[model samples]
Target: MFGGRALATLTRYRGGLGAAALAVAVVLLGLIEPTEYFALDQFFELRGARSPVAPIVIVSVDESSFVELNTQWPFPRAMHARLIDLIAAGRPRAIGIDLILDLPSARGERDDAALGEAVARAGNVVLAAAPADEQAGYTSLPFSYSRTTPNLPIDAVRKGAAGVGAINTPLDSDGRLRRMPRRQWTGVEWLPGFDVELHRVVTAAGLPAAPLPAVDPILINFSGPLRTFPWVSYFQVMNGTVEPTFFADKIVLVGPTSDQMHDVFATPFTRGRDQMPGVEIHANALQTYITGQPIREAPVWVSTVVAVAAALLAAALVVRLHPLRALAAVSLLWVIVTLFAYLVFVSGHAWMRGMAGTLGLVLGYGVTVVDHFVREQRERRRLAQFFSPEVLNEVVRHRREQSLSSSRRMVTVLFADIRGFTALSEKLAPEEVAEMLREYLTETTDVIFKHGGTVDKYIGDCVMALYNAPLQDPDHVLHAMQTALELQERTLKVSARWEQRLGTAIRSGIGINTGEAVVGTMGSRQRLEYTAIGDTINLGSRLEALTKEYGVAIVISEFTRRRLNADFLTRELGEVTVRGRTQPVKIYGVLPADLRKHPRAVIDVSATLTLSGAGESHPVATRDVSEGGMALAGVPEAWAVGTRVEVRCEGGQLPGPLAADAIVAWRRGDEAGITFVALDPESGPIVADYLSRRRSR
Candidate 1:
């Protein structure tokens, strides 16, 4: 049960948190972060230097060119001359310009005259070819399509040199230039980009070449994710500063590299490099192609599954575990994966994943934790509603106490009954009886207020009331006695009206006793009840039943009567033997409080004839009494003392059976008889006390 409850609680907790967490994870993983993650992936593809193998190197017009020339966008044609002279002096292979000479500019006539003459003179030069992009009247054809503006200058470049290389680098969604364009179209011809053009140039110049390895294209023998190669400034190369022989028989590709150009791309070689140019990317691409081993290209579905599954798995695991454990586990997994991913990039020439996996685990754990706590609080509230009003109060008290590491004490109990209730019920209609009973009990119950009594319950016409509380009452007996007397007076008023209406009279009797009993909640966890209970409670019940034997309307046990401190008119009802008690107890009746002041103390007894009339002497032990009945163990089976009989005593002749049995109460289940002879001495005082107490109330 414990394991099941714990598991269920954990499940519910995670279930709720998972829902909200799922939403956040979806937003971040699917919508917001993918673009960035994919972008990183793209940049890595290009800079990874592991694909589209081809031998090539950059001849860049980077920050150095701009800074030395004191100009930004437009470079004088004479600059092209100096670059060409340097390459031509080396007697090198192909030289592909990575920039555009698209239209004539301010110094165009002078610069173009010098550069064009020099370009025509140099046998190894490939002037840069600029296609009219969509922004400049070139239609957005697929990269393979040859659509362009009328002034693309492709024919002019084709006529001026060994070849016009298309220098466009194709990028993936991640903005990384991974794959080199296989081909680019001009108005009249198909062409290779700088990487391919340079490849042809190098080979024609008698360089070594080999078949490239490929996943898509081929991998290049070049630095991986973090490796770096050397670089020198363009202006320095042109000022007769570089050893031109290094350029000999070497293929060079060149273009701009400045942050202002906004040509910067995400690549593995340099982190979103500001001054790297398009020609450098092309050079990287060629190296990748020539090396022949491309990074393994995984299918798209693999990525999606890995991302979502990682999220779900981590979430499920943490749903039942403690939060700290879940978090530590997630963190450890993240670190392990990150290390492995870096190794793939460094050693395997592959980029796996970065932040996506980490985010998935964290989101899973967080969502489940939030859900668990909310469910716990709600369950406690739901349980509180399932108990009865009385029991609920006590259970709640105990529960609150338990939370604070405490508990409640046991309570005392008392029970009372009306004498001759069966005969009373026999004379009335059910409806009339019910109405009268309700009114009578209501009045009696109200007296419990002065007595500090809590009415425990009602059984037929009987009342079970308790003192010493809902809390302890210091003078509980006084309260019980006072309350009982008030009830008697109130019953008289209620009975008078009903008697007139029903043409019948009513009388009630009460018995009360008190003792400590177990008092607290007891029941199922789902539903608990609070009540006092013990042998003390059972004793109170047994005492109420014995009231009829003594022929007294109110009888209290020795335990109860002893708590009283005040003196009052009273009568000693003969010893009454009750069921469940092996011994008999002396019971007492509270005399009416004002018995001395008025006609009071009413004692009413009724006896049914159980056995009588035969001519036999009753047992001797049965004949000894103070003019009162003794419940005899040795009575004749059928005895009739003919209205009176004498007892044979040891010392002298004793009282007759009729006289000795004067106070024998009504026979109610093996009961002794009350004879008329014993009533003379006590009748006046009892009646006076009953009336007096009734009046006081």
Candidate 2:
């Protein structure tokens, strides 16, 4: 039992659970490193260009330099020595050589000596080194640290340079250089990157060191596409065409930019054939540190939390809203997430993947919509058992607008039962009884559904139905009465067939009442039933029982009688206090034309009536007239259900002026039923003659 209850509760909140599940899935997918990297690259492309904080210049060994010097693949070390001496004379903060110089110069020992002497004269140069692939090392940190054998510059040149650091440009899976290590861990020592070593050289020259990123692989904040930094050709610098003063007070980065040299790699800002040179990439990295603004990645936990939260929120909202409105809401959320991510990337230099969250919103919406469709289809199947196809369509189409939650509504309750069914069932075989009941119930249900009534439930031989509930009906009372009358007519045919089979007839008693009642699906979560409960429904059931006492096929309360037009003939059965009720209820038996004893003459006459009890008078008209009683139309009140009233009729083919004193019998709407207590002797003959004339006509 407990498990059943728990299952029901979970079903009730399945939308939320589905959303949470989607969130978890999205978060897990977002944690993938490749996805994060891809998002980071997109953010870089969208952010476009930004100005670098450090004043840095690139000295490029371009195709023009190669042509101008007519030098082979490896330029003579004396040539580099001349360029270094000129840049050092300008008093630059630091000079970084991006080329690997781990081998002796092919131009001879003296050529290597010349480059070593020039690096000693400079006193503030950082040479690039590499990590040997065969020697791998390990560390215990959150991010991976590069561990390998050290590849250092030739000792003759390395001994003279201020620092020697690894030049490692790690590419994402897509083969794009976007990040670099702050430092590499060799077995014996930690070697900083080329840019980090340059920063050290600058600080060693008495400049304050900028703060470095704490993460091992620092995300390089590219300034822009290729050659964003100021560039001068090495050939121009060597031949005195470019002044050495241009390098003063700046960090100089010198590396090959010629396509022939093949020192270029793809980057976020560079696409297809437009790749950034290796030296320019190092310049951007150095500027990233010098500006103290490396792109910081948001914590994994934080991104996961945001994506999940967004998905769950989407689920909660879409589950309750219309499909079109939910789609619009999801689209708006996507825009907001994208804009927020972009702002953080551009302004704060922080990478927070928004694609996962936005994708979560989309998926959440889709799943909830699918779930809603399935639930609605299930509900449609359930409702089909209670409502006609037309009514069921209306209910399902406007379900969101008219929810089936329990609420108070003015409705007409109907109860019908086969008279003496218990005794009749005992006398028949079980199979016979089942067949008999099935045919009887099916016919009666068809009658109820014909008038748009909701079949609430069946209790043994009795069926309870409701009108003006789950859907609105302005003429619910009339519909219920019509259904009851038709059911009696159809039962006669059923009784004939059953009487032939069992030598006993079957008759059904129907009762209808209209008033305010609580109506909707009600019961425990495990088993819910759409039904109604209140005094009105109880009174309807009581009246159905009273039909046997009155020997009538159908009975209705005063509440229902008042709503009918003069077309329906009814006989008042006086007031009786039903079981469980202190107040007496007035009921009437609906009679067909053949059963009415005293037929009322249909007449439309203007008249005036005075209520002696209330001491009030009002203009009235006659709906019909009989010798015993008359229905007074336009009488606002019932005059306390027995108060004596004087009615006067004048003119309008009434023979002559007639007056009578009558006792109020019943009242409904603007009409009142009254029986004549006495008629003035002079007017008695006149009313009789007038009614006779109307009947003859």
Candidate 3:
């Protein structure tokens, strides 16, 4: 059933069920980019912004320095020559000028010559270049532009600088500079990026490139947030206001650092006002490439595997655990996964998809919670069909525990079947027959429940039930007898109604036996059921079958009769060999109504009695007595039949002491016949006491 229900749920919610599919779609379609960026920021925050790499420094031409220069926006190349000389004086390993001087200075050839002389003297300098698309050709003029080529320094500066490299930092769609294009094809040849070329010129031997495809560029592992690099203002360096040894053997990058210059960009390490300037991004890139630890992203297939595994694990946890606990567990799992990804990225220089995996896990947890709630409701409704409310509650309470192992238990099993069900069905239309059977079974089941019995199951036209099992009933046999009497009385009215409609009456038979039997959830695993089985149950069934032969509506075994508490009226039905037993079993027919013509036999005995009448008591003697009634002599001859009298046996010569309320049944002259009134369960055990005394004697 659970399997079928699962299949149904899948079919009902097909195509897209829960958050699992949504999460997968999100990852596949790149819909997780924004959220993932946020998560990546959090990871960076957790890792703590790193310290800037040493051996690299920025000489920024900040607003203060720009004003201090006291020149136009594009300062005279003569001034640039002075700054280049100042930086070159430090004997740095390399000097990279991030500003582009693609054209000769309009100031005159003297200014250009001044800058070129400085660049030529500084043999370790590299000039930045930019892509310029035009008619392509090689040129000695650095300022000359060409299609599919880079605009480089003026001829004077180009002839002076050691090498040229592209200063292009590519931004992702979000406008965040996370990666750099490693190389670009100029009309002449492929050239390395600014940082790569800087590393090449500094070390004089380029590092081995990664095993990445040509189209896929290198990811930047930013060393820290903005302004992390060691720095000195252009004015400070030129004015000689700082230590001269600071730039010794270090790589220096010079660029604008003023918002007025508009050289800032967003990066992963950006926080508050900490936007990175281009020069520092190049510094970080140089450090990353030189150290040979560029951040490497795993392939898409690897991310898919991680996402699926996390999702399945999360779903299982949600199904097995309570909701709040599952949420806490999932949160912990995400934290661990994110931390692992951070460790891998930081220590191993490999980027992993932590955010995508986390999305899958959270979605799985949510879907499983919803599915569990739906499944539980379905299970409750299905179980309602098989178990009563009380039983169902107990079963649910102990569902996690195994409580239904097969074991021998003492119980009373009852079987009630419609007599001549086949014959009755033949005479009526199919629908009418169904209606009649349904009504009879419903009433019979109600009677069984009224007596606190469990309807184990219905066998076609027969209703099998149990007592003192699944729940306990101390007076189970007496309860069974009461249930049978009520069914007989109730069905008689139903039979009468049916006889009027169909010209035939309905009749039912019930048999009850009490003993030990195996009672529990039985049958194979696939078809298991809660019921009972053993000789006692078989005997109950056989007894019901024998009811038709005995011309009785209800027959109970002697085992059941012996346990009654004297309130029920029953007549002995002579023993007969049942199908499976060697010995005959004594049976009794339970009477639903009084039988005034019950057989009476002659008996002569003197019995003492105390009588209550008119709110007074008197003692009398009995002429003769039978189980049906006692004939008392010398009573008021005027006492009429149906007179209510209460009697107590103070001391008697009969089989037992008796105390009961009785009614006058018959009388003749000085003799009156009185029968004992039927007692309730709580009343004193009259018949049981008599039987006990008889057994002792």
Top model number, lDDT: 2
The TM-score obtained by model 2 is 0.52
Listed in order, each prediction's TM-score against the native is: 0.41, 0.52, 0.50
CA-lDDT, candidates in order: 0.56, 0.80, 0.74
How close is each model in CA RMSD to the real structure? 35.5, 30.5, 33.4
Per-residue C-alpha lDDT of model 1 across residues 6-108, encoded as one tens digit per residue: 4654455455345435645554455534553553455455445543333344555667778886766667767777777777777767777766766764574
The alpha-carbon deviation from the true structure for residue 512 of candidate 1, after best TM-score superposition, in angstroms, is: 92
RMSD of 3: 33.4
lDDT, candidate 3, 167-256, per-residue tens: 877877667888888777766777778877787777772323333334347777777788778878888887888555777787889898
TM-score of 1: 0.41
For model 2, give the 10-residue run with minimal summed lDDT: 591-600
Ranking by TM-score: 2, 3, 1
